[model samples]
Target: MKKKDSNTIAQNRKAIHDYTILETVEAGMVLQGTEIKSIRNGRINLKDGFATIRNGEAYLHNVHISPYEQGNIFNHDPLRARKLLMKKKQIHSLIGETKNAGITLIPLKIYIKNGFAKVLIGVAKGKKQYDKREDLKRKDINREVERALKNR
Candidate 1:
């Protein structure tokens, strides 16, 4: 038997700077054929995307998988909500945590693992303005130190 490698399709870069991710989990996506095709072609965007638990199930919103050009009327909607496959208990836990102030369920990235499309979702707390500034300061300091060392 051969081992299959995972390939990343898209990432949500803004999510990292905007939220302090507490935990991450892999979840399966319920996608249509056309949507999957579009994703495979690297036409997906998860920048403004998020996950929500509703009616005992989790759904992904704001994820855009560009319409597959060849499929006329059968092509799925680009920004349509997609269901996330997870255990019921997990869904309940996510709902409870998100009910707390400032906590949220955000999509971190979308990737193909062993030929299956999967989503990496994160439980995160929003960062304050000052927090972002502090992170930027630390990053700059580290860069300057590295440059100084390289020059020596």
Candidate 2:
């Protein structure tokens, strides 16, 4: 069998523009049997996804995992909340930090790691409109510089 580095299923590109990621951690997912199969087929969307803690358990919210094509009867709900697996210590810390103003948890990406489904959770703060605009300007500048270098 060949060992794979990762099989990225979905990403939340909006998270990058809306939040300034302070920390990132890989977390395992609690998926139903059919849900995992759908994720393996890259039928997932993280566009509207976020994470929260309830009763000390972390759950991913708003992530859309399309129902498996063959899972006619037992397919999981596409937008149902899914549990995220993480250490007790990590969960506690995130909970504490989120008590402060403007800090929240965002799910950045979903991927398969070593054959297990995992989500990359980012501890992030909401970015101001100006911050996002500045980032875009910088990106354009970098793109133009690369293009000029290519032509030289």
What's the number of clashes in each of the models?
0, 0
List, residue by residue over 46-130, the lDDT tens digit for candidate 2: 9888899999999999999999999778778899999999999999999998999999999998888788999999999999999
Q: Which pairs, if any, clash in model 1?
A: none
Candidate 2: C-alpha RMSD to true structure equals: 3.8
What's model 2's lDDT at 67?
90
Off by over 4 Å in 1: 1-6
lDDT of every predicted structure (CA atoms): 0.90, 0.90
Off by over 4 Å in 2: 1-6
Scored by lDDT, the top model is 2
How well is each residue in 1-152 modelled by candidate 1, as lDDT tens digits? 22433588888889999999998989999999788888899899998898988889899999999999787888898999999999888888888888899998999988898888999999999999999999999989999998999999
The whole-model C-alpha lDDT of candidate 2 against the native structure comes to 0.90
Give TM-scores for every candidate, taking all chains together and pairing residue i with residue i: 0.90, 0.91
Error of 2 at 66 (Å): 0.9
User: What TM-score number comes out for model 1?
Assistant: 0.90
